[model samples]
Target: MNLRQTINSVQAHEKELALFNIDADERIDEELRSFFRTQNVRITTAQTASGCPEEIAVLAAGETVLAVVEVETLRELVDGAGAQSRRLGVTDTAYSEVLSHLKETTFTSCETADMLYASREIEDRARRNGTGTVHAGFQRCSTIVSQQAIYEDLSRTGVSVHAYGVPDVTPPELAGGQVHAVGGEIADLWFVVYDGGSEESQKSALLAEEDSAGRFYGFWTYDSAIVDSVCQYLTETYLGGNGQFPQFRA
Candidate 1:
């Protein structure tokens, strides 16, 4: 399946996050709620007369409660320790927490900033592992100009990198990185898929479509099977028939 269809396959499942005893300022409260909504997770709040020491957040799929974490921890995620942390780095920790409990789940609408944070997280993981096949789609090659360095660094680590986009700009040199210039449905997608080179535990992917000017609707997944499928489709569709690169390995 294509990227959009792959996302739709998992988007069928629904999940929710429930907050209990969340006594926080309206601004903070709304921010917390907005954070989960970006991931396509619904939020429900309830307060108890006997106030607890900390606010609790629970993730559930239908009647099954999947994960439980402190609401304050989530607040810390969005607000960060200071100005620098608030930028985007701290949110990686928060995304880890959310991903730990929710895998193969769809995130409804992710802003460019949100997608940027997540894409970096997945790329960082592949860099640290130093082994894996990374596929990044920029929609337009001009977009790849800004990320040229990032992919170059990733390729240096022995992670095979493939950059895809419309042939709108000259392809930048990316060391071990391979640039795929083409046109079709891929022009509307923004994605990053890493096939955790020899390890299933390290597999991860971020797939989204630029539905509007700056907003993308999609999901980030750590599921190896799902990740493999995405990588397979990209490899076959873009690299197939052409002996440019070998097939993607899961």
Candidate 2:
């Protein structure tokens, strides 16, 4: 399937987040709702029930509670130390913490900065593991240039790196990385997929497409099967019959 089709497949499994035991403060409640609105996560309020914890937010796939977080923590996520700001890392809230709670959840109309944060997280995993294959699509060659340094560093770690984009400008010469200057449908997509090398638990991917200028729609997932599909598609479509990317030595 094409990149867009791959994304649509994941989007079909919709999920919802329900807030519980939150203090009756309209401003706080409204802020929480507004924050989730950007991520396309459905937000609701429910009375603290037997199974659900007080002052917690429950993320559910229908009846199954997939994840939960404290309402106060959720607030800290949306609003950092600065009372009026939506900056991340507020009160010790980490970026990985956000990923843990929001993995496999769809986000609509996200900014480029948001995508960059998610991409870096996956890149960092591959860097630390010092193995695996990384597949990234930057939409344009210039965009790939913007991330050249990180990809170069990843290549130095012996991680195979494949970068894709339309040749809108000259591509960077990444020493141990392969640059696929292709066009057509791939030009509209931005993605990062890591195979987790020999460790299946570390598999993760971030896939998104620009819905409009400066606005992105997509999701980040840690599911191994989902990650496999994305990496497989890129391999078959770009790497050809060999079905293998060139390995780089550390």
Candidate 3:
């Protein structure tokens, strides 16, 4: 669904007593109002960022409230509000934990796409290499592959693979037949290949390329029998389809 619809869903899920506290500044409040209006939601209060102790207390009590804190206001609250403003200890402990959890659960459009791509790349490389290990240069990159795989494999009874983090300057040849690294890196690079055809004739492939630290790049492809074979391969390989990978820890 679209972003407005998504926000509406969140608002609908919220409890009736949940308050949406926004900044009192005209410009900031107007911006937030526009956002909530698009989702057919309303703000309960518009007060100075530092003037929402009651709202903060409610949120700290585990109420599902939405608060709009300006960047400057967030900084002020975290960095000591001085003698004139009362400090809301809720900001650091309760609010911070909730925000962190929300941040972890939420994914941006680009981030979701990147994660899907990374999962496919890792799975395809593992299959092409005929090995269980998928090499990544960075931990974030590896985590993306592992996390996706953990979910995908659990849903399907498929062979799982492991991820390895290698140095950027590591030789691609050492990574077996399929090297999976970020594009343009010295190691093997993975890319998505789309088949431009009708639904019945469409296909997708994961292409991998290996390059010396600076020279002699070579490429290969892992072709699938069907359009969704690539996605299925990823889901089964990492996350486990049909709950098969129950204990497969990332």
Q: What's each prediction's clash count?
A: 0, 0, 20
lDDT of 3 by residue, 100-202 (tens): 3222111121223333453454355434433222323222244434445442442233323223223334423221122223222212333333331232222
Per-residue CA lDDT of model 1 for 5-88, tens digit only, reads 987877766678778877555455567565555454677777777876358888887888887888777776776544444332
Which is better, 1 or 3, measured by lDDT?
Answer: 1
Arrange candidates by TM-score, descending: 2, 1, 3
Candidates 1 and 2: which is better by TM-score? 2
**Which regions of candidate 2 deviate over 4 angstroms?**
19-28, 35-40, 46-58, 65-101, 104-106, 241-250
Model 2 C-alpha lDDT per residue in residues 1-250, reported as the tens digit of each score: 6678877876766667777766666356677666555443577777755745778777776677777667777676666535422322112236344435454444555577767777887899999999999999898889889889889999999899989888778767888998878876677788999999988988988888876565678777777888998888888877874755432221
TM-score of each: 0.72, 0.74, 0.25
Angstrom error of the Cα, residue 14, model 1: value is 2.3
| Pairs of colliding residues, candidate 2 | none
Local distance difference test scores for all models? 0.75, 0.73, 0.32
User: What's the distance in Å from true for residue 220, model 1?
Assistant: 1.8
Candidate 2 or 3, higher lDDT? 2
The TM-score, computed over Cα atoms with residue i paired to residue i, of candidate 3 is 0.25
